[model samples]
Target: MSNTAQELKAEILRLTRDYSALVHRANRAGTENSVPFEPGKTTVPYAGRVFDQDEVEAAVGATLDFWLTLGPEGEAFERELAGFLGVKHSLLVNSGSSANLIAIAALTTHKLPANRRVQPGDEVITVAAGFPTTVAPILQVGAVPVFIDNDPATGNARVEQLEAAFSPGKTKAVMMAHALGNPFDLSSVLEFCRRHDLWLIEDNCDALGCTYSMPIARANALGIIENSPGIPANGTHVTRYTGTWGDISTQSFYPPHHLTMGEGGAVNLVSRPPLKTYAASFRDWGRDCWCASGKDDTCGKRFNWKLGELPRGYDHKYIYSHLGYNLKPLDPQAAIGRQQLKKLPAFIEARKRNWEVLREGLAEFADKFDFTLPTHATGWTPEGFTWDATGCRTECSWFGFMLRVKPGAGFTHTDLARHLESKKIGNRMFFGGNLLRQPVFVQLRKDRPSSFRVLGAMPGADEIMERALFLGTYPGLTTTMLEYELQVIRDFVRQA
Candidate 1:
């Protein structure tokens, strides 16, 4: 409560208001005529960064504070995010990829009861259409990843195929993304996890606002309607919202993701024990202290306890619990995140509206081109839409689209990609489509073939991914821009 500190806080608040007003004015002034489409020159991205003056100003103000490391903004952002997601805990990390890595890595801890530990060579079932980080954690930890072929229709894994990916002897965990902003069949997956005692990790990077419900709706989604001692299961899944399920769910704060903390991610856990919660302690230099970033000595005796039989009185600050990394993000990034979070409601609504616009524009082509519009599971609301290009005839949210070429479709993915590229529309494959096809996975898979398996051979994965591309649906896009992009798509299809 120093005078200087109070003054600084006041100044920061001033800047936040100033920046927000500027953004508001800019939005009002820049109407339809302000932005024009530049054919053959402008880049219509699959996804891109979207920020207003609020984000820019928050980041700039944090720079003035000069804390540089995790500080007020980081702590506030973590708490705000946890509150928003309705989770008990949220730990910010350097990247969504790192968030996934740390989340999956946390499961491998021997500290957890043995049944929960993901043993080496044990299978972690997932899809091939997701970003590499989703599966990289499995390989990084020496575990086997059993790839499940995605349903071309939903751009999600086939729930009926869950049993096929599991072998009683090897499978220990199930990790999968919600496939762009669309939800996976969470009810069945949760049941499958319960039956097999598998660790469920939902990579919510792409599906941040999604909510899910159980089919039976008799009790809690994971069964045992209430939380129990030793093993807790009091998680309520009574149709609240989307982007809220998982034994341990993760979120991304990268620029292209739902929210931006520049380059950051968070690990969230709900109603877990102090012991399980403390498991994440290792991530922040593995310290025993639970104090927020700058404060210290909340535990009265800072150097009175002896751990690991070291000394009569060892420093608590120096105590290390688990092998971990310095994955924490800087406060400025978190400051930006806090500000960005304020706009999430609007951002989500814009994405949904844009998705509808794209859906309407491409409705006529639905039969001629194979397009799979994602359908939300009961009781879930998604942030965006994901369509499959299996028939090479699809219309997804224009912020970005996914296309999977069908067998004997009379066109190669490259041809379709080039066709779009020539017309000034942007395109990209589903992240590491058939990740096992990548060179990095060759050695990992070769060394542990039996421990690993690919769902349905996923030959279509390559076709869908290679042909798949998306356009930007970020908040920055306007209706005029989206319509112009749609025209480009229509023109390309007609010529083909």
Candidate 2:
């Protein structure tokens, strides 16, 4: 590396920081920088990039290195993210959807035991609502998706239906998301999976910073031994981030997620060294070699592999192990992610606080709306949430503040969404609510009824589709912005 090149990179980064600081003040954490608030005039985004000069400088610096492909920066970010989540490994990908695709694909590999390997016609249980991609990959891999209902209150799978959704010999895995950053009924889910010897793929894209816990006895019974890093073990419970509990979990680093890498996601190998190889194979074009990008012969025997009728001593790099895709993100994006990871704890706290504020502010309208509750929450008081009898609990770094309009609230969710939009407040319905109702699924059902299975009437999912909407609880929301959102909702509810 020449001195001239080093100096040029430093100058570019310095100017990049200056440029970003000037233009991105409004995008900084709300506690750090104030964006002008004009009620009904300024747009209150549901979620957006919340970064300043640090992320910009990192991005610029990585770009200047000219290694556009996933490389040094990606490796650093993966290690940092895995460390943060207490996972064995994190494999970066282009999007959360791709991470999910790779996770599911990894399960299809022949490397696993025949009974455990997900094959065509094998069933993977998933919730009916929430993001479509979480379930899409099941069908993509030629496996059947057994759709269970979501609990509208928690916006997560109805764990009690796990047994009903399972098919004895055919059910191979469970793939579901922690909806809206709320951890699902992991205790029940884990128990069910263990009982059936099925794989668990947690789509943790929305719940990156969320924590779930069960009594130490219960956690031990389920074979979970360690709390995530930085979470104190209080002798009563085993607490871990949502992603770390499952066999393989995924994250999204898109702008709206817990952290942004422009466009990135990761597949987390939880407590397993082998899963890393399988998942990485799927993420890196199904290559048999374990070499990182731009490097070779990490395995030392790269030329000695013979599999799938390939010639003996064939270069392992060209040996295809599984049908896979190239889903890697750019190095610059990961560089930004590394910066975002540094601020993630604060971002998480902000999200939790923002959601709490919304919940408390709207408690008076509980009659008009059914607000989201943590998975084990029985009720919410001004002081705090009351727990269910399960002795299990969840702490959400909420993706959004979800609420469902009451049946007799004199207005529909659509009406309220419009009202909020008219006030320039951003909102979103639960993604692909009642996914079966979406055109893609409807056609899928019509074309091949055997392609997927639905457990029940999915009334809960239907209820969410018809009644629920969510407001942004992202870290970028300012006091003024939140106040305006609250005021608009209050006015609308009173008018109704």
Candidate 3:
């Protein structure tokens, strides 16, 4: 590039920074006491994008480059994210829903041995109380989703039911999310999967910074090493991030997620190289070639591959390996992600602090409602945690503060939710609560009753569906906002 071009690029970047500062000023000024916390007036969102000039500038800089597709920014973001999560590889996708889809679809690839590959009609153990997308991929792949109950207190799958949900040689995988950023019982789930030789896919989209401690042997078996510089070197167990505990895990980078890339997600390859290849193939148009976008012939003999009865010297780039989708985010989105990633540690800390404040502030009303705090296999208290018998532990990066209206309480879930809404305080039900009760499942059951299986009646799941809701613990929630929310809740409970 000539000196004139270099100067022009610098000017463009400087102008972008100036524009970004203006945006930041406008955003802050607009939101500053914009609406007083009067009933039915102020709106406190349950989740939202919390960003500043850096993210805007990065995005504008990438747009100026005009490399619209996944490129250098995407590659760097992927590496940085994988390193943050202590995982081997992270393949970017268009959305968390697509990440879940590709993660499951990759398991069905022929790259795995026939015995290990998830075949059509095989069962995948999952919970039915959370988001639909977490379970949708199993059905999409023509596999049966074996439904299990969720623990109302934690809003996670009931781990004790693992054995009941298992079917030897028939249940091929276990795919579930860490509900609302609270991790499930990774110890029991890992043990169950290992015992049964089933694949594990942790939907880590909601719990990116959460940590779980497991026996070293088990962690190593899943290809996780506890080697962070600051963490204590305990020889017996390894404390790995939630995303690294499974054969495959996923992350969402939507505006409301832990990090924001506007609309992006990633399928993390935690255990196997072949799984990475398969997932990448599925993401990159199902082609046999491993080449990045706009590049070719990474395999050297791109014209000399013949696996599926095509001409012997057919171009490898066009060879369809598995049925797949083009689910990739743009380079500009990834550039924003790179900036967001730098802010993630602070964001996670803010979330944790906000949750603690809510927990503490609402302790007085604990008798009125069941506060759903994060739990682990090990019992926890404010002072410290007691390790489970196997020495397993969990550290959560909470996504929200869940509250379940206790049975026999004067106020019902609907009553409290309505009151919160009337106060313009945002809240959310556990996503698709009791998903089996959803219309789609009801219709499926009515039409083809054999499509999915359920374990014994899901009373716990019913409890959550009837009583559970959550409030924002995202980094965007300021102390003033939380105090106002607390006051609103206090007023509602006292009146009730």
Which is the leading candidate under TM-score?
2
- Cα deviation at 181, candidate 1, in Å, is 0.8
For each candidate, the alpha-carbon lDDT, in order, equals 0.68, 0.93, 0.85
- Selected candidate, larger lDDT, 1 vs 2: 2
44-89, model 1: which lDDT tens digit per residue?
5555556666776788778877898988888788888878777677
The predictions' CA RMSDs to the true structure, in order, are 5.9, 0.9, 2.5
TM-score of each: 0.84, 0.99, 0.94
- Which residue runs does candidate 3 get wrong by more than 4 Å? 25-41, 215-230, 234-236, 377-390
Whole-model lDDT, model 3: 0.85
Best candidate according to lDDT:
2
Clashing pairs for predicted structure model 3, backbone only: none
- Let me know the TM-score candidate 2 reaches against the reference structure: 0.99
Q: Which segments of model 1 are wrong by more than 4 Å?
A: 1-37, 214-237, 240-243, 275-279, 375-400, 405-410, 447-451
lDDT of 2 by residue, 111-230 (tens): 999999999999999999999999999999999999999999999999999998888999999999999999999999999999999999999999989999999999999999899999
Q: Per-residue lDDT for 474 in model 1?
A: 65
